[model samples]
Target: MTNTQIVIAELPSDSLTPAHFKQTTADMPVAGDGQVLLKVILMSIDAANRSWMKGATYRAAVNAGDAMPTYAICEVVESNSDRLAVGDIAASEATWSNFVVADAHKCEKLPKVPQLSNLMSVYGIAGKTAYHGLISVGQPVAGETVLVSAAAGSVGGYVGQIAKALGCRVVGIAGGAEKCKWVTEELGFDACIDYRAPGMSKALRAACPDGVDVYFDNVGGTVLEAALFAMNEKGRIVCCGAVSQYDTETPTGPRNLPGLVVVKRLRMEGFIVMDWTQNDAKALRALQTWVDAGQIKVTEDIVDGLENAPQALIGLLAGENKGKRMVRVAADPS
Candidate 1:
């Protein structure tokens, strides 16, 4: 059997584009001991994929000549382990490819549910990341003012709604008018400021009159710097992602960090969602309740074809995707 895959083309440098990847064909790997062969159904394009190319951050590097790193939903074609069965739908950290040979230890069967696609969009990595960062790290309380950067994106969108559920006044900073409208009118954010607008600092100041108590940062650059200036006493900064500086040679950082942390007694923390895996079941149950009752919403920007995976990732890094970036490789029989 043949498999189509994308692999790192050369040593990575700053400002990655689709050209950094090269498409190739290879013989399919047979399922070996304690392994499963998965037919790729769909995959996610995430900011972490960009970091994987430039050495390692919180994990090992993706060596050149290896498959491009990605998180994907897969269907079990064959299995050599007792934990998984053939035909089970599972999620795994796989390659940007048509098929993958993964350790059965690495794949987990997805819960059978109505609206499986919707579940994947909202309750998968994006949703889980938001929940873990907000509840576990930020520890937001009622009546506090919460601010989120990248407010229209996957994790940010979920963070806004979840914060509101806890009775916090939510303000968001997105890129444009449309996203600001979506966050405020549709997602129930108290107010969402467009970071692209002139006088963004003034806008943020006006939107957050009482100062920001909890800040969820996804696209950390100058936006974070602005948030730092507006932080309240004992505020919390949850460093979820830094998409804005992902491909930069020298990533810019917050300049006002010193005074804010010292004067405000702020607790700023960064986390990887995978570290909190033991608590996922509880988070998922709560997320399910919110999603079922229309308290949370989901959005996806899907691109079709395995061949277009590189381009999809490019769009994700460029902030072209309106929500979670997804690539549909094959039809889901379920």
Candidate 2:
């Protein structure tokens, strides 16, 4: 009967930072027709969550005072729909709560990973976001040089690995030396540039000496401008999520966008991961197979308790999280 949830309310103007989630409890909802009750396991702490907390952007503005928009992996505790049953593991949009009542249609049965605690990580929304953008937009060919910004983050990491698997040379651009080292040494990027370094444009040029063919952009401000100058003719740029400017009070618009797309005859497209909903199943299957075969790695930074969800979410925007950030709401013994 206990239901613990993380809620964000309007606080005093100046004190209302991203670290403002409050924990409260209420009576848990029972399963209804076409619904299933989920014992929340893992919830994503994403840069996107920070935007949602602010309540202005198109994606972040889920109706005022509604549960936050988050994807979580849960175990079915009760089911009124035949599609799911007790003990089935699934991924659903449960936000930041210990228990959730979700529509059966929105839940996807998870592939059981005996040794893994968060299969929903690489096989979840973050993985699918990378798969869809890289495959659909990047369309990388063998021997091409591909570039990725926010290279050490969730979707960016996947994009680099997938591109490398497809035979392209991958170059990653991250903000720090440690991240740059991981991108090159661990993720197998052919080169990794520290964007925070002096003369970053020169560093980027040196990394992609042969010219970039596919650019997967996660941090859009100055890095995007630099990418424009470095791309080869007919290059493709897949604009995923822009974490760099997500926290500013006023939105920071792109500066060299038009010229960048024009002179180089490049094709740049921006897309939301939800737009690829039709390909969700295929993407999940591919990611799962890759994980099983050791072809890809799923990195996660998890924080315990729903109470820490707000801080974890804030950490994501500030680039404090190394991989897919998550909040573990309840311990699922099953």
Candidate 3:
């Protein structure tokens, strides 16, 4: 069978446009020497996916003539390994292609849930990332003022809700007026500041008159700078993905760093959720509890087809997606 994949057609200098990627179809590779063949179900699109196209960081870049790197939910259709089976479902850090063949080491078996689509999103990497950032790093307390940047987006949405459920006064920073309304009205944030507004710092200050006790940041640069200035003494800053500066060749970071961290006595930590793998089960259980009690909700923007995966990633980097951004490669098996 032919497998279609989105591959890097040209190297991007600063930002990505449609021209940087191309769709290619080739015969599906066979599982060999302890490898398994996977059928892609759905793929998560992330801002970091942009960085991968640019070359060299924690994960190497997908240069010209290379398949884009991505994470996916898949079914193990054929296995040559003792660990994985034909019917097993898994989460993998594989390239963005219709089908993948790799050893068991790169894939992790997923938990069986009644609703795989919805539950996979919550129990997947996004949920775990939110848990590690909010509970592990931020550790928000009741009555504290919590501010979230990119608050209407996937991980940001969860950060605000979880902080609110902890009894903290939650405020969010999103791009547009519509997202701001949804964040406050539907997502339960006390208020949301449109960072795209004229006076962002002033608006955020008004939203959190008491000063921010916790700041869960997704988009960095100017937003991080603004949040830093709004932070109360000893406030916790959870550094998740920095979407704003991801596209730049020489990505500039937040200014006034010491003025906030040293003067404010802030505890700012950058984290990769995968580092906290041991706590994955605990975090998943907590997420399920909150979801069951109606304290947590999962929202997503899912696009269909492997051919449109490049556009999904493109839109994701441009802040076009409202919730957790994903692309459905095939119909989820019933």
Candidate 4:
């Protein structure tokens, strides 16, 4: 009868909070010609969601009075195109609503998995991002030391594991001691440094005595500066998300920019997961094999209900989540 939606009530000028979002109801959307009606099942909660509000990077800016944009896993309930049929599962660019209309050509038809959430986690954006960013851009070699920031978070955790599977010594930089312990003991990283602790440079030096051959940076500010200093000559730096500066009013950059980059001859490259669309199938196959072999562990932090999406993003930006965070909008079609 009606569709529940979460829209940006007001754009945040500083740190984001739940107050910035509002819940409302709208008439159910209908499938049009060459489009499909989708019942949203799972919505991804990412740090980029916060960054999108500030301004456009790879996509348009999220302005006030607009439905929050997200990549969602949905089930087609009504189809107006030959590309999809009723009960088909799809992944598409959708809003924070229980139901939506998406172009049939743009929606990706997904296979039915035992757990649909896997389509949002390991087999989805998190795993693919880590795979593409590391393999394509980082170009890590065997026996090298791979360092990743925000190691306990979604993408960073997988980056370290994938590097380890490739016979590289993996080290992580997380926020607290507990997260650092999890990164080392559970995720199979050789070492994990607590960036919040004092003497971070010394601790990083101690952890990476051989120097870092590759750095997968997620949180940009000081952690990036620290990793820059520890980088080996000709090391590769994969610039992923900048979680540290996403939700702030005044964001700072890593002061050791071109100077350290030029001196070390480090190959630093930034990328979005969409950049490797041609190799998505290849990456997914490799990820599935690694999952089957137990080389990469999938961790998901899911919150129930669409109304909780705002708090989920806020918590994620505050470094409270341990893995890929997502919101369950509706039950999977059984």
Candidate 5:
């Protein structure tokens, strides 16, 4: 069998489109020594995927003619090492392909869940990111006002919910009225401001009457600037992904940078989820407990078929997805 793959046909100078990617077939890969062949089950479609194309951030740059890279949940159909065996489910850094050969040592074996898609959502990068970025970086205390941007998207939604469970008053900033409503009503945030509406700064200040003690910023354009103006003294800013700037040719920085941060004594920090690898077990346990107790509600936006991965990412960047967005490549083994 041949492996179907999506490669970067051309790097986007501005906005990304389906024309930037090309689908092609290649010979099925063989598992070499200490490697395993994986059948991709789910591929995470994140804003980071677009940022990687601009240049390297935490990882290597995605050049033209290279298969688009992704974080994937896969099944080990062939193994050459003791780290994983055939039929084991694993999570790995994979490319946009039907089959991949990865070093067994790099693949993480995952526990079985009723819905394998959960492995790509709550139990995966999205939930872990929210848990670590909010609790560790944001360091919000009970009764304090916590504000999060992109509240309707993957990590931001979880950030708001996790803060609510911690007894902190939560507010969200999203693009539209519907999304803002979902953030407050469904995700349990105390209030949500539609950033697309007029007088965003005023609305944010009104929602966060106590002033924002912790600002979990996911989109880092105007929303971040607004949050900065509303921060209280000694507040913390968790710099997650910058979704607003990812899909454009020109990216703008938050206007009120070190000024607001310095005046408020705000602690601003940026992190990749991998930075807190040592705390994965603790984070996972907390997330699982919250999920079991119904304290954290999980939402997933899944697109079927590997060919639609490009559109999935484009839509995600356009604020079309409501929660954790992923592309389904294949069905779970029955």
Candidate 6:
């Protein structure tokens, strides 16, 4: 049978653009010992894809001539391992493709949950990353005011909700008015500021009048600067992502970082989800419980077809996605 894959043929030295991807065809691989064949169901698009565009030298997780790296929900079509069944749904990091041959050891059994659809979302890696970043780094406490950048994004969305659940007053910073509304009304953020508006610093200051105890940063660069200025004494800053600089060839440096940290005695930390790989299943279960109880909300933008993968990735960098950006390579034939 024929198999299709998205390959990164040319290296992208600058920003990651869709033009870097090259689609190709190949023969499907047969199931090997301790491996399972999966029909791709859904795959996520994240800024990390951009890092892989430079090839594997810097990021060992991805390489040239290799399939684009992604996190996906898949259906096992064939299994040589005893743990997985033909119809079982599993989540794995299997870039862009219609079929995947994954080591049985690498797959995670998707647990049954109330909002099953959100298991691939709020209970997914993105959700867990947000949760851990906020709690482990931001360390919000009851009555503390937490501020989050890109508050409408998948990670930011969870950060806001998690803080609110922890009894902290939450403020969100997004690019537009609609997202600002969702931050306050839907996600229960105490307030939201539109970063694109004039006087963003002044607005953020006013909205966070009590100062920011925790700052979950999804969009770095200028937003980081603004958050630094408004941080409360001894505040904690979580460096979740630098999305604001993803599309630029030359990323802007944060000029006010030293002042913010030294003057306020603030603490800032950066973490990758893989650091908690050992705790994924544990975190997933906790997030799933929250979703089952309607305590956390997840949104996903799904683009159909493997052919759309390149553009789907491009859309993510352009801020076209409201939540977890994903590509749907196939619908359940059943």
* Cα RMSD (angstroms) for every candidate in the order listed: 1.4, 2.5, 1.3, 0.9, 1.0, 2.3
Deviation from truth (RMSD, Å), model 6: 2.3
Where is model 5 poorest over a 10-residue stretch in terms of lDDT? Answer: 253-262
Q: Which candidate comes out best when scored by lDDT?
A: 4
* Per-residue lDDT of candidate 1, residues 172-212 (tens digit): 98888987998798889999999888999999999999999
Residue-pair clashes per candidate, as listed?
Answer: 0, 0, 0, 0, 0, 0
The models' CA-based lDDT, in order, is: 0.87, 0.80, 0.85, 0.94, 0.92, 0.82
What would the per-residue lDDT of candidate 3 be over residues 53-157, giving only the tens digit for each residue? 666878775789888878888889999999899999888877778899978877888766665566446777777888888998999889999888888788888
How far residue 207's Cα lies from its native spot in candidate 3, in Å, is: 0.5
- Superposed model 5: Cα runs more than 4 Å off: none
Estimate the TM-score for candidate 1: 0.96
Q: Which ranking of candidates, highest lDDT first? A: 4, 5, 1, 3, 6, 2
Query: Local error of candidate 1 at 145, Å?
Result: 0.7
Range of the 10 consecutive residues with the lowest summed lDDT in candidate 3? 112-121
- Comparison by TM-score, 2 against 5, better one: 5
Per TM-score, what order, best first? 4, 5, 3, 1, 6, 2
Better of 4 and 6 by lDDT: 4
Q: What digit string (tens of lDDT, one per residue) describes model 5 on residues 1-334?
A: 9999999999999999999999999999999999999999999999999999999888899999999999999999999999999999999999999999999999999987888888777888999999999989989889999999889898988898889899999999898998988888899888999989999999988898889899998899888888888999999999998988998888898876878888889899999899998998999999889989999999999999999999999899988899999999999877
Cα displacement (Å) at residue 270, model 2: 1.9
List the candidates' TM-scores in order. 0.96, 0.91, 0.96, 0.98, 0.98, 0.91
Candidate 2 lands at a TM-score of 0.91
* Pairs clashing within candidate 2: none
Runs with alpha carbons beyond 4 Å of true place in candidate 6: 55-64, 112-116, 277-289, 332-334
Indicate the worst ten consecutive residues by lDDT in candidate 1: 111-120
Q: Which stretches of candidate 3 lie over 4 Å from their true place?
A: none
